[model samples]
Each structure stands twice: as structure tokens, then as C-alpha cells.
Target: MFHSPRPLVAAAAVPIAFGRAGVLRRPQPRFNLVVDLTQQPFSKRWWRGLATLTALVAGVSQLAPPLGALPAGTPVAEGSDQARQEAALAVGALSQGSATGLTMSEGPLARPIVSAPARQSRSLSLIVSPGDDLARLLGRNGVRVADALQAAALVRAEKALPAPGTTLSLRLGAPDGAGQRPIEHLQYRARLDLELVISGSDAGLTVERRQLGLDRTPLRIRGSVGGGLYWALRSAGASPTQAADYLQAIGGSLDVGSEVMPGDRFELVVAQAKSADGRTLSGGLLYAGLERSGGSDLSLVRVPLGGKLQWISETASPEPVRSGLLTPVAGPITSGFGGRMHPILRFIRMHKGVDYGAGWGAPIVAAADGQVIRAGWTGGYGRQVRIAHEGGLVTSYSHMSRIVAEGGFVRRGELIGYVGSSGLSTGPHLHYEVLKDGVPVNPLGVTMVSRPLVDNRLMAAVRARAKALRGL
Candidate 1:
């Protein structure tokens, strides 16, 4: 045990008494001593006295060992008579008040020992790379194999692991008795609005997921056709998906390749989900318009009608027009509308429509804007769909492998079904027909027209929405 020499210093001071005037008066021949054990050498007797005092101050039954027990180079010695004389002279000077104002410091070994500060844990930041998983990342960062595997299992169970290039915050504790530095905690962004935290010691682990309430902001973009429609939209901060939606909405009224010339202006409004930190998520176009140099401006808006999203014209009176119909399939005509020999029945019969020679599983789109009235298996036409258009005109598609648009209003160029050889057919092809007031007409010769407005109120609402989006 070690003890400071401050108590011994006070004990060596002279006594004081109070005088008649209530003032502190020192005794005759009073002196103050400041013994500096640090700077002056000491004899064996002095060392023994210090050891005895240390034992008494520590309340120990046994006295401390001599100062000779310390490491070599200590100033204390048993046979240094010169050192003893110097110490005696220092004590005599203190008694005579010769060192009243001097300060005495103890040797380095006689001072109180201080312990070093505690070690703190270190933190590391890591980024996930291509073809890397949680286990592999943790292993490479000096985590134990068992711990890495356990943490990976926990992350996989949540199914919220971040993609490549995501940053991960990790903390490593100090090395334990086994010389192993275990992971303290890890943090990662699981989604744009959610963050995942994994933490624990070697005893147990815990996982936490925090949600960030993000918001969706609507934006409007307007620009001229500088290089191309796609480039112009991209330059105006429109994503590829949003640009595609804009093109599809106005495809019925405008042809980008042939109709759009240089200096044609276009505008679009889109809604995008964004986090608090300005990270963009999914987005879609809400309205779009195109103004030609010398032609009518084409405007379209998306509206919620009958629990479904429908794109309609911005005009108040959307009348039946005859310019927006497209050919459903792209192939050569196999049969024309007229009397023909039935291949299966081996008899002459009147074919009311045309047949397209297309490969099996070829995409079949709508010819005009209309609503699907029938979508099911017909008598001679297996897997058929009939759509009612404007001017009391109806279009029917027969011999389809599958129907994608069922009982809904579909725009021109939107996929309706796939080509197949079903029912009374010779090979893989599509049987297409056009009808007027319940009478079958020649599909190849008949002109296609747009459908009339079903609900005036819906059209009015769509127009209002378009106006609002345009002003955004």
C-alpha cells in the first residue's frame, strides 16, 4: 500500500494559541517546514520512518517493506552517511525558519500512482458491393464467423436487405479476454422510408425497423422538341417511365415520328414519391399535351372512373372521330371478307371478316378506343373478345391464346389479346371483324372511329383536372 506524505507535513507544523485581543499568536521560535522528498535523497532511517507512517495511515497490522525493495536507481540507501547528514541539515533549517518560504517535492516513486484511461470502442462505415451479402461483408470486416452467420440469418428473415452500394454503419467493441473484437451494432437503410438496426452483444441480439413518413410531390414539365420527344422530356426532369406514359396517353391523337416536327411544344405533369432527404421513388404521369405548329393541340388527362384509372380527352364534348384507329396485329392478310370455302367443313361459306396470318402468341392490340363487351369462349371462335366503339361500331377478335384486357375500356394500341389458332381455324392466326348496328362489315375496308362520351360529368372532371395539372 502507498500513502501521500501530506499528513506528515501538517503533523510537523508548530502549535498556535489565541491572544487576549482574539488574534491567532504563534509560539516563541515558530517555524514551517516543506519537506521535498522528490528532490532530496533520504537515508535508510528516513525510509524506515516513511514506511512506518504509510502502514499507520493505511491501518495495516504489518509495516511496509523498505524503499530498497523498489526498482534500482531509487535515491534511498542504508550506508549513505552523507545523505543522512544532508537530510538532518534540511530538518535543522526548517526548525530555524531558514526554509519558511521554500517548497519541497517528493521523488517520482513516492508520488501517488494514477491508472490509465479506459479504452473506447471504434466505429467503421462499410458499403455493400456487387455480389456481396451481409455474411461476407461482416466476415471481411473482422467479425467472427458464427456471429456473421447469425446476423445474416436475421437479416434474411426480414427480407429487407439493402441493395448494392448502400452504406452500413458498424461498431466494434474492444477485444475481450479471448482476443476477439465482436460487433456491437449495425445500421442500414432497408427502404426509402424505412431503416433497419441490428444490435446486441455476444449474449443476445435485437433488430429494429423505423419508418420515415415520406411524401409524394407533383411536378410539371414543359419544353420544346429540341432534339427529340424522349430527350426533351428527359431534359425537363422526366424519367423514362413517365415519358413512356406520356407518349402512350397521346398516341391516339398524335404520331411522334411523322406528325411531330421541330419546335413542337409539349407539357406533362407527374407525381413522384420522395423521402424527407430528397430521394425519389416511383412516379407516373398524370396529364400530358402536345401543341403542333399548325395543327390542333392534343391534350389528355388521367382520371379515376369506376374504381379504375382511365385516360380521356381534355375537351368537354369528346365526339366520335375517325383518325385514331390502329391495326391490331402486324402481319399479312390470310383471308379477306367474302364468301370462302370452309376448310374444316369442306363447304362454301361466307366469311364476314378478315384473318391475319400471325405467329402463335403474337401480341394483339385494340384497333380503336372502346369498352370490352364480351370476353370469353364463343361457339366457333374460341377465346374471343368483342369491343363496342363509336358510331354504333363494334370490333371482334377471335382465336386468341389469352385475353389481357377483360371487360374494360382500352385505348388504341393497348394490348387486348395474343394470336392463336383456336376453334375453326386452319393455322395460327387472328380472325378480326367490324360490325355496324349489329351487322357484320368488312374489317379491311371499314373505317375506324373513336367512341363517344359515356358520361359528361366524368369528362368535365377530367377537363378540370387537366387544367389544374397544366397550371402546376
Candidate 2:
């Protein structure tokens, strides 16, 4: 669908075709065409068909024609009551010429057509974001408050909402004087987030917060505590140009899902390739730092290790050991495990596990190192996945955009699925549940145990380095 507010041609009686050169092509002549007119003294179909044939043969089907001309086609009926009637009408129409001041071969009837509005010549574009109040954003851009509200209302009616955190584009026209061009229009995608209470009443509100940020030379990326990670970073001002580049460089280098936490932090050195005319072409991560929620930090340096680019980490921490309970998605818990009424169907049922709020199709990560037990649709769960962790502990994820890899063993941080609101869900959320011995357990209550880097050799070196940094 086009995001711009360009003029659209109305549905025409004669369908128009196009060519490889983007030019509108004329319709091909309908060979062996037939017409019937016996039933009615002056039949509309007979005249219309005759006009079409003439127009097609003349190569000006779009133009109107006068009455009285020859009918060029014959009818070959294939046995039916309607066919017999059609044959009679065809014979009658052929015998009579100009009986109603209209002839078959004359041409199409002349009818006045409304002219299209003159198109304004200007550049156009659209920018969409999550949680941006369209009217307020437009108002800030100098549009009148009333006009902004009207525009937003129109867009909402158009159902142009993109998935949460996903950016939807609109055509932007060049500015005219102090305001945007009259042809300019903007739209915001629709997105919703859910919040759950750990210990609160139904009449109240509970809020949990998480934040991830880092400002280092050459690179800056911020992760959110509750919204879709990609969307949050984008909304917080991370450029798509840079984020996409970073994702491309480190795509398989790390599992962003399992490694991300509410307080996760990141910093990196990015190198940009530039043109002599001061245009930036591309860039990639050169060095980086990432810290998880439990204080596990990984330093990344891209260097020629064995004549190949390799990621080297210094000051390795053991807190991020493969526990296999980590999920690829990072954000706040939107829905919690419990029996409640269904959001859409209003059915009373049990919802197992907590759901992480995120954009539809957001990548889902393996919670821990485990082999997949199930990865397919389950009735009300839509696309579901079950993974078996250590000690007979199993985790389940439901309602996914897709199962990337399924029914296969995976490490603690491998990509397994994507976020979605399929099945009985009303919006995008990662429905995650943990079960032990076929009984559900509160995932949040289970503490994630990590093998701290407390090795004697590593500890001694770290202690010595700390002492040296302190000038001891």
C-alpha cells in the first residue's frame, strides 16, 4: 500500500493494463466476441459490445463513438435456455441497423467524465514510530492543532498501524514557505503494551522499569526496559543506518535475545566509510562492550586472529554462563501466568507463564541450553514451542510470528522463535512458561544460577589488576 496521499484512479469499466516501461497499455481486443439483443427492443449489452469491438479495432477504445455501424462478430451458443435466447437476440440485432438511433459498430456512448484534481509537484515521505501521539507530533512540526487532529483521525481510520516498534514510512512533500506542503500527510502505526502486577489489586496500577544505555566514543546504543528493544532504541534516537549496520556485523556473533536484560548496557567503536564529497557510505562495529542484567560484561575487539577477523573479549565474567534459562527477547513482563478471562474471546481460562511485551516478529531466544521438545501450533497457542532445560525443567513459548528452527537441540542462547499475537492473544507478547515435573512454577521466583569466574588463576590475576589500578 502506498503511504503517500496521491491521487488514485477510480475503478473503470474497462480495466487498464501496464507495460514494462511503466506506461499504461491498451486492452487487447476480445476475439470471437458475440452480442445478443432479441429479448429487449433496445438492449444495452448489444450496443455496448458493438461499441467495444469498434473501439478495439480502431485503437481508440477510450474515445466515444456515434451510432450506426456493422457488427463484426458471430455467436456460437453451446446448448442452454439462455444460449437459445442469446442466439435469437444476436440474429435480431444483426438484422436491424439504426433501429434506436444507435448502431453496434458506431462507437461507445458519449458520457461526461469528471476531471481529476491537478497533481502538486513536490517530494513526499512518511515517518512512523511507536507510541508517538500523531496529533501532538504533527503539531510540534508546526501544523495547526486542529489539522493535526483531523489528519491523525483519518490515518487511524485507514488502518495504517505498523507492528509495535516498527517504523512505517509515508511520502513527504517539499515544504512550502513556513509550513509543509499542502500535499504532505503523516501517519503513526498502532501499537499496544500490556503491564502485569506481581502483587497488586485489580483497582490499581503497577509499574516495573528497566533501562539499558551506554555513551561511548564513536557508538551509542540504548536499550529499553519494557518496550520492544529495537523500537525503543529507534524511538530513543538510534539511527536505523547505524543499528542495522551493527546488527549485520554481529548478527551471528551473539544472541541479542538471551544476552539482553533490563539493565543491560552497550558501547562500541564504529568505523564509517565516507566518500570524498562528505557522504557516508557504510559502517560496522570495530570494538564493543556489552553488559547483561546480572552484571556479566563482554568486551569485543575485532582483530586479525589467525589472519581472520575475530571477536576477542577481555575481563571475561562467568555470570553469563550458559544456564539455558535465558530467553532471546528483552523487555518487561507484559502478561503474567494465571487463570483469567481471555482478552478477545472473553473466555475464562488459565494462561501459563509470563509474556514479554514486544513487536510482532521480534526474535525469540532459547531460555537455556536445551533440546526442543515441540515447535508447532497448539490449539489456542497459535505457533508454540517447548524447550527442555536441565533437571527436567521445561519452558514453553507460544504465539509466534514463526519458528525459525524447530524440533532441534539448541544452546542456551540460540534463536528459536519470533514474537507474535496469534491464537488467542490480542497483541504481540512472548507467552513464556516454565514447568517442572509437569507442574507449572513461577519463572521469576526461580533464581538463575551462574558459574562466577572465581577460578583461582583468573581471580588472582583480576585481584592483581584491581590492586594495580588502585595504585596499591
Candidate 3:
């Protein structure tokens, strides 16, 4: 038993006051405890009470759960941007439509701290700046690094990520304890004809590509070759690729610069695709026509014939054999193949081949792709090389300075010999002769086979289509 003087314990009430402005002010609790011990200091009973309090606090701490690290969208320091943001968040906690706050869900330490929103989740507009990729845009806006990486990787799987200068609409879900918003849904224009929608859930992200409606039609354009055909097409709303392909399709022998006068009417039909809003996306040329007032019109079409797609001339005879022969040398005809006086012998005789007055030692290419059957020195034609082309058409090149190809196959335009007064020549010239079954024929004539003829039904179909394009 402890014998001591009695101690006094009392309860006090805090007084409330009213201001002169007629406002009621409530007083906060003033728990200023006063302990009056009537016994001497250092009592065993006092020590026992302190020990019990310490033990109770220790037990409570041991029963509590461990805490997880708080997620920070960015690094934080005093007087830093993060600090300012924290202050904003503090003020926003009391109001609606402000910076977000956090609320502990279930067990405080182990469970996640969900974002207690000021209002319902709404899609925020973010304009894609120049050179800003998906990951960079999302991360800069407080999205988790993990979520951004996952979304980007999924988009790259289908095609490259959307280019810059685009708009992305996103719905953000509640942020975790780490201040990063998880993506709820995102819509992006992956391409002119494609749209992508990305959705995120606890089970992970899912990506879907939706094809936009497209209107495909043949783009027929006709205009005068004012200034130039190329620029005229561009001025008439033709794409660069479409106009270039049209010129190339008609470039076999017809020169667009000199032959297509400014007065000529140029017509072009190209494959084009357009959006519902009338945005153009065009492909190569399908037909190119040149209408001339002085001469016959030139018309060309790219159509399938004999199981192969090939160029067809609508004006000229079908499959002209003249297209097969390539000029053996570059020079004007010095002598014709018909009867004429031989230049060297000075006598009237039949000239079997045409003579080309080329420069000395100039390159002489193969007339066409063929195998060299007869080469080396001949009777009168010095340094002669004879190559046999397909369809029994044999071409002989005489008066060459030297021969490089004696045997084996040679391609057209390959340097086979150099021009010189080798044999039967009085000057530096190339004597080109075309023979059919050992009989000399006109070298400039269409001396080869024609292309596979188009069927009657297919020709009718092509003609009808061309007529449709030619109509006003």
C-alpha cells in the first residue's frame, strides 16, 4: 500500500465568444493538463504507469502493416515544380475541378491509394506537338512510364506510330499511389485510311485498328499543254507521282517536250482513292492520251494481255515489230541499201547494207540481244561481227576497228566493237546489214516478231474502256 496526500483532478470548459461583427466563433479545445502530485518525486507507482504506456505504444506499432513507397510522377524537392504542384493539390483538395487528391483504399499501407477525383473522368485534349512521339507525349502528361511503353509497343506492332501534328483523345482512369494516371481509352488516326482505338484494363491493354471508309475512282484529267504537260497536270490538281508516271508511260519514242506542243490537249487517267471528306491519295497512271490537231492522236493504255500486263498503242498497228530493233550505232545514213555507186570503187553497184559515218574509234553496240555466230575478219568487211537475233534475224556489223565479243551471248547496248575503217571501207564508218535467212533485207524496216496479239474479246473491252475515258 502507498500512503500519500490526495491529488486533485478537475474538468474545465472553454468559453465561446461572439464578435462585434455579429459572427459566432467557437473556441477550440484547450487541454492544458496540470498534474499536482502531493507525494515526493521518484515514486515506484509513477515509474510503473510510464512503463505501461511505453509497452502499449510498442505493441500497437508491431501490429501495424508495412507501408509501400508513394508513386511520384516526377522528382520532388523544396521550392521545385513538384512542390508548387503539391501546393496546388493541397488547395484543390478542398474544391471541385482542381488538382487531384489521393484516398487510401482498404488496408492503408499495402493497398493502393486511388485518386479521389474532383469530378467524373473526362477526356482531355492534347495536341501532338512537332516531333512528339506517343511515349514522350504520355509521359510528359503524368502517365506512367510502364503504361506509355506498353501502348507504344502495341501501336508499333501494326504500323509505325502516328506521325506528328495529330490530335489524340484520351480518357484517364484513377491514378495509383505513384501519381501516374492509367490510360482508360485512347483514339488516334494511324493513317489516312485507318484509325486506332486503344483501351486499357486490369487485364492489360488491347489495340484495335478500324478502317475508315474510302472512295476509289479513276481520276480523268484533260488540259492543254500550256507551259508544259507536266506542270499543266500539276496545276489541274494532279499529284506529283501521278503526273510523273503519266509522262513515263508515254515516253518510248514520243518526246513530250518537243512533240507535245502547247496547243495539244493532254489527257490522263490515274487510279485514285479519296476519303469521305475529299482528301486525295492517288496511284500510277492507267491511260495517257495526246490529242494533236495536225497529226494522228497518240493513245496508250496499260492493260493485261496474254497473261501479262504490257504497254499497248491505240493509234499505231497492234504490236509493231519496229519496237524490238535498237539502233546499232549513233550516226546518219551515209549510204542507202538500194542500188548506188560504191564510194570506194566508184562504180554503180547494188549496196546490200547502209553505211553510218561515225567518228573513228567510236563505240559500236549490239543491235539487239543475241548470240555472236560469225565474228573476226571476213571477205571485204574488215573487223566484222555478226550476231544472230531471235526469229532468224541476223545482223552484221562491218568496218569495226576491233572486236571485244567473239562468242557467247551479248545484250543490247553492250559495247561489242569500236567503229573503224577495218575492212571494205574507204573511211571511218559503220556498215550495218540486216539479213533474213542469208538474204539481205532492209535494216530500217520492222524486221522482227510482233508482241503476243490481244484477243478479240479483250481488245473490244479495252477499246470500250478507252472510249469511255476519251468522252467529254
Candidate 4:
């Protein structure tokens, strides 16, 4: 190794001396290192040895007390500069400091360097599945992408999309939660990333599924009569349209107002719609069945006929039979069949049928199915309609109110005549009568056929048509 001159050193020490006058006097000490090889006659080898000893003693003295006791002409070695640097480094390593420094000036340090610990984990995750659009799913889950293109950009950046599989992952460098500021800590840890998964599989294809709940829809309502069938339906929240249809269904044979009794009840099956999120929107159809106390059970059925559905009476046949006549001007029937003797006639005339009392202009509905044979003002009864029945029976409505267009097949319940006191000893009352096989009989006592009498072939055809109409 090449030799170098001695290193120069300077030191200053101030001693505080106490004087007899009680005043403190500061005496400063000074030191400096100077090499004058030109003025020396000694060999370099001798100087080198001296310098090595001086360097050892000086360096060792740094770790001891009374550092100023070193000899007066202490020589420093050629590598004294490196030795001083090393000592300084050792002291620095023992002391705590703000700026971290490594002991690798020569090369990398031989000892393992320990680094500070991590405050939190940076891994974050987001889960997605099939049926979820990139933009929409991100938006709903508190992940934001400006638009479809931006969403695609995010997907591309993460290599996640389309096919159901693992999607995205991110190693964050800071602590985080939703809508929160991130911070660094030495003890806390968190993981963040996105995971895409296939929710379901069927026939070699992946599918997505979700569960949702729905709310109840509003109730429907309608018009009805008394605490009977109609009233029961109304209380059950049936709509007006439903009520009208129900009335039309049972109105034919059953007199709704008079037939229904107390304690009647009904049940219905309603249809409704649901939203994508499973919220009930509204309801529609109100199919129902009803039962009346002291009365009969009722049901509504849509009977098909020639590709069309029609409401038909289930309790009785839709057809009615006609076989009777009435006298004029019967305002209100003072007597009916099977009643006591007449108040005016006294001699027990034995009423053959129910009498309907009405004023001279009151119209009369046809009692049953028949054809009008005579319709005019006859000698005994003023205006009249004599309808001939299916079994050689004839009926007449006698009165002066007036007669409708005659000489045609009249259906049951058709208006035929008006009420009047003509050709009879009655004041505005209808003389109603029924005849069987051309013989007078009590109409109330006769049992009329419930259903229309049709040929077997025609009935079969009708049934087939009805079935087709019902689509069943």
C-alpha cells in the first residue's frame, strides 16, 4: 500500500475555572495535527510504525476517558483516514436516527437488513356473475365506470368479462373502505380484488340467478245487492266489472234480490302482475264461488260456444215454457193459487193462477216460450195476446193497456200485452190462466220443463261447439 501523510485533526475544549473573586473564567483548549516530513532525518519505516501505534491509541481512547492523555508526537498511519470513518459508522449504527443509512460503503453489507413492516394488505376484490352487465353491476355494487366504453376499458385492463370466470384483482398500496379516505398503518391489514363467477350451469351453458320478494297488489271492487251473493262479493273486494258479470251469470232463473238470504259467503281467485324485482303491480280476473244459507250454491263458468265463451245458468235450464192467459187491469194480485176465498166474489172461485194487478197502461211480459196465435181486442177481453204453447196449450194476457206486434214466435219473458179492465169484471187487473191439452189448469201447480228440448244430434253438436269454444 502507498503511504500518505498524517491526517490533520483540530479540537477545542473550554474549561470553566473558579476564581477567588467568585467569578467563573472560561479557559479554552486547542489541538491540531501537522506533518513536517521535510524537517525530519528519521527513516520512513520508523515513521510508519510510530504512526500505526498513534492511530491505535487515539482510536481506542475515543472509547475511554481523559481523551487528551495521548503522547505529544503521535504519528498517524497511511490508512488512518479509513479507520476513522469505520469508527464513526459503528457509533452511528448504535444511535437512533430519523434518516435511515446502510453500512455498505465498501460493498453490500454482509448482515441481513431488516425493513419496516407493512401497515395493511393491499389486495381488494369485487365479485360478479352472469346476467350482470359490466357497467350496471359496477354501478349497483358501488363501483363506478363512466359509460359502457369505460366499463369495457376497465374490463380490458383487468382482462375480465363475457365468459363467467375470475374477473379482476387489484393490489392496493393503502387502507380503504367504501367512500372512505385511505391511510397507512403499521398494524392494520385489508385485501381488495374482484371475482367473477358462474352462478348456475344447465345443458353445458352457464346461467345467473337472483332471489327477490314482492308486495301485495290493490284489491278490486264492484256493484251487488243486499247481504246476499252480491254483497258478499263486494265485501271481498271484487271489482265492478266482475260484479256485473256475476249478476248476469245467475240472474236468468234466480231473482237475485228475493232469492238471496242472510249468512251467505263467497271466495275468489284473482290474477296479478309482478315486476322484475318481484313487486306486485296490480290484479285482474276475479273468479269466484258463492254459497247462500237457506239458498243454493252458485258458481260462475264461462261456457264455450262456437269459439266464444258465454255465461249460462247452472242452477236451471236457460229456456222457459209458456201456457197461460190473463184478464185485464189487474193492478196487484189480491189473490193467488191455493189461497182463501175471494174477498169480492165470496163464493170461493178457487183461483187457478197468480194474478198480477196493474193499471190500464201496464205492459205484460210473456210468461213462457210460445207463438202468438191471436193478438187484438177481443169482445170479452180488450187487447190480448193468445200464445200457443209446445203441447197444444194456449195462454192469453187480457187488458186494455195495449198489444205489441203479434203473430210471431215469442220467447219467454217477452212483453206481449198491457194491463186494462176490458171485457171482464175487474178493475185494472190481469186475469192470468194456464191450460193443459186445451183444458184449464192451475199454472203454479204445473211443473214446467227446466231445459230446452232439443234433438239428440243437435245437442251433441252443441256440446262439441261449446268444448271448442272453451279451448279445453
What ranking emerges by lDDT with the best candidate at the front? Answer: 1, 3, 2, 4
Total residue pair clashes for candidate 3: 2
> For model 3, how does the per-residue alpha-carbon lDDT over 1-472 read when each residue is reduced to its tens digit?
9989787544355455888898888775543223223444456655555566678889999998878788865444456565546655764333333455654356756565454354335477778877778888888887789889999999889884877777888888776677778888989777779889999899988999889898877788988878878889898877877776666555543544445677888888887788886777777777888888766787877787646455566644455455545666667789888899777789999888888888998667776668899889997899899999778888999989999889987655556888999777788999999998889988988445544456667667777778876673
Alpha-carbon deviation at 57 in model 1, angstroms: 99
Report the number of the highest-lDDT candidate: 1
Model 1, global lDDT: 0.77
TM-score of each: 0.50, 0.37, 0.47, 0.32
**Overall lDDT per candidate, in order of appearance:** 0.77, 0.57, 0.75, 0.51
- Candidate 4, run of 10 with poorest lDDT: 183-192
The local lDDT score (0 to 100) that residue 29 gets in candidate 2 is 62
Residue 91, model 2: Cα distance from true site in angstroms: 36
Tell me which of candidates 2 and 4 scores higher on TM-score: 2
Best-to-worst TM-score order: 1, 3, 2, 4
Give model 1's TM-score versus the native structure: 0.50
Model 2, span 177-276: residue lDDT tens: 5554332433332322211111112332122222222222243444443444455456655567555434433333455654456656655455544333
202 Cα displacement, candidate 2 (Å): 90
Clashing pairs in 3: 71-178, 382-423
Score candidate 3 by TM-score against the native: 0.47
**Candidate 4 Cα lDDT to native:** 0.51
TM-score of 4: 0.32
